[model samples]
Target: MLSTAGRHIISGEHGLFRDQVRKFLAKEALPHLDRWEADGIVDRSFWLACGGAGLLCPSVPEALGGPGLDFSFNAIVAEELAYIGCNAGITLQSDIVCGYIEAFGSEAMQQAWLPSMLSGETITAIAMTEPGTGSDLKAMGTTVRREGDDYVISGAKTYITNGQNADIVIVVAATASEQGRKGLSLILVEATRPGFARGRNLDKIGQHAADTSELFFDEVRVPVSNRLGEEGKGFPCLMAQLPQERLSIAISAQASAQRAFDEALAFTKGRRTFGQPVFDFQNSRFVLAGLASRLQVGWAHLDWAIARHVAGELTAAEASAAKLFHTELLWECCDKALQLHGGAGYMNEYPIARLWRDARVTRIYGGTSEIMLEIIGRSL
Candidate 1:
């Protein structure tokens, strides 16, 4: 009964895992999202539940205590989460942060961290952006001075996702005696360390359920063994992982746009105005028609990019293009959907209002639209 596109999107073992994850989220996550949004953070219990359900770190290898799935499994989870307007933050931790560790972490580091991370006993966050640096990662001020057996880290990172509850943080810092990007190294800092402290949960215009905060490191000492990959290799490591991160953002954006369009369509069909259903109006019909066409094109592009990524053929430019186009289109869809809802869309009680607010951040995070353009332009 599924279309070819649907079948292609969810195939083989991934389809089974996708269905299971959907059911788990519908039952366990959706119900708690409102309360979590009010509290500005999802409870730790949800992370443990996701781990027990085999939803966290599904792509991790069996030797690391994971199900050994691929990135498609993570994409499915992202779609499901966005469909329900839930930014639970667990998906980011499991899908994005876990990839960084699995790909770049040393064998000993992976052995020590992967199992508990897969079990959701350990939460993780990546610190790259500083108060003065975001897309300009090379401008970071965090410094790590190497001692005989340890490295001393002192810096502050702002707008860090999952900062409040992360048990292990992948910190980007400049190694002493080196300059420019060559000095950068990735260090793992345990949250229980004395010098590591989390600032207040940031109050933002959207993504209320996802905890974004400022993190401070005051002379934190980490053993050199905690360094990820080789010294002075952090810049290249970050560059390599960015394509996947961009693709993840694109996946979320596409799903959010589709859900907004669906909600708008159902409302227009049922609501009457000027002695006829809103859908009967020529303006409403034309608007919905345009949105449907755009949605079809956007879905095709996303599916194509996803296929390339899974095949290991996707380029950085292709991933950046997907993120740029989908995020821009998502905001357009949200705004138009809100317009179609008239006064009801402006009310906080409506999901469209929330969707509209949430859509604004997609363009800003995971590398802004402008930064995406710069990356694309350099490829030409």
Candidate 2:
């Protein structure tokens, strides 16, 4: 097991905080996993429980109704949750969405939204990927047309996390259609608006406990004050936030890889073949040895990235590299771990099944491996 006692990046306070999170999950999340997976969404009561535990929006300022903690606290929440195979979207709330609001939201916008978000009474999602636009932000078709002091939104977003449960959505729309990427703006839209609608809760191969959906805006109108940051500056805003967002995914991916390795080790030792433990077989031991070596190196690099991020020294390209490495490591570890389980691994009754399923998407989201390479290649 990876020991926390000597990790320089994690101080005593972070260790204690992790313990509290683990205990909370044991009591509040573990027992409900099966039900949540079946329902395709976690209950709102769980979100309230997280808020009461001070687990949401750890980095938001006290003035904005948050704990005023740093990014390390957010990392603790992500690591603990992912280690246990929980896929709740709490990190999206704390790590990604809160930062955008804190950075660019106006006084009125902050006052109106941050407190409820901190309390978990409000769920937020950022709509970036449009119907045919994959990683190309310049190609999105969503539009925010200004008319008589109201901005009307019209477009659709798919594969959105927190979509089915989002109380408010930060929509990325083209304010000046001819300008391409420069025309995009981030506009906050309430879910209660007349033309706002959520399509079906998407059925996915994994991460069933977290709701992903299709979101539509048919001429949904909001006041001019709803714009976040400067008009036509949304692309840069997203670019600035991508580093930390990618780092968060790396944190979760690293912890999850460790969990997969642990599960495989335990299973191989327990399951016997030819009157001997599977772990005793030469091929099994070799596979595990390779995974173990990679995991040790992965954890070290992850800590370095985390420390760099906490110091505000991690660049977009570096964060992209970390995300690429760790997520790919997660896939390899999960795949090997499941192979060690033989036929039982394919059955949903085993924990490795879910871990394997969840690991597949890590390489695809938070920017794909190909996109990460492009970003890094440009830096080179």
Candidate 3:
């Protein structure tokens, strides 16, 4: 348990939730990751299992057909998923994508989707990145134009998480292209709709079990009711919710860093070199000591971020900073842990190698480290 303010950050109810998630992952996730990695996607059965375990969209209120939990519960699920390197899209679904619907969807729309989403029967993807744009929302080229009572959407999205299996997509497109960012709006695109298509499951360097793909919309049409919030107000909603999304990235990075450090410590203590255990060597001891110090500070930072987020007081800059610091730290920890493994680390058979690969994307996705720095710099 992470200690903060003279007590563990996780309380009684939270502890029970954590235990449930830990046991679920142990039985259903950790064992199958190897096959999932090889396949570049997780099975829908596992996603259904996660839903059955109450591990999706946890923060949605009971009135909205959720468990009425807060964001900390969401954080615990992310943390436990990251701990075992489960690369499926649960965190993305539960933490980032679901908020769009809960916060902006109309009562009818929420009723239509939230229940199935919480049940894991429906998977979601958010289409924001395009072939030509990333990080800059203003650069999006997808357009959704109103035609009488319907929206005609035409554009393409790439690098979309959950692309292959999404039952619904929250599409960010320009409803009024001349207004720049103000022109942007989010619309719900169901997978079975006409002219909606999934393109390549883009080959990524890591997080293979989480399907990332290119999506195409050729004059796709949906009722105006499918629009989230009001016309021309989507960017604000995105801005409001993105802090939590970045914090989710930070959560995953923090947990993965700890996992790598733990794995390296165990590996070094057991493996022999020069007639002694690697942990007995001065160099190994120093490296582990340095990582130990960083992990202590990381846990503190993460706890602070989670508290602020759950209280709805975490700022965009703070969330960006958390993302920037922890992801870079994750890369450093993974690299160092791999180095400690010497030859074994370079091999795919070791978890550190996969951890290092996966860490690379943390800095790239959820706003790149450079983007996070820019977001933070504006506050100065």
Q: Which candidate, 1 or 2, would have the higher TM-score against the true structure? A: 2
Instruction: For candidate 3, report its TM-score.
Output: 0.97
Candidate 3 structure quality by residue, lDDT tens digits, 124-176: 99989999999888878999888899999999999999999999999999999
Q: Please report, in order, the local distance difference test score of every candidate based on alpha carbons.
A: 0.87, 0.92, 0.91
Off by over 4 Å in 1: 1-7, 176-178
Candidates 1 and 2 compared: the better one by lDDT is 2
Candidate with maximal lDDT: 2
Tens digit of per-residue lDDT, candidate 1, span 30-85 = 78978998999989888888888888877898877678877888888788788788
Report the lDDT of model 3 for residue 49: 90
Cα-lDDT of candidate 1: 0.87
Query: Every model's Cα RMSD, please?
Result: 1.8, 1.1, 1.6
Tell me the lDDT of model 2 at 217: 97
Best by TM-score: 2
The digit string of per-residue lDDT tens for model 2 on 95-208 reads 998889999889899999888888889999989988799899998799988999999999999999999999999999899978999999999999999899999999999999
Worst 10 residues of 2 by lDDT: 1-10
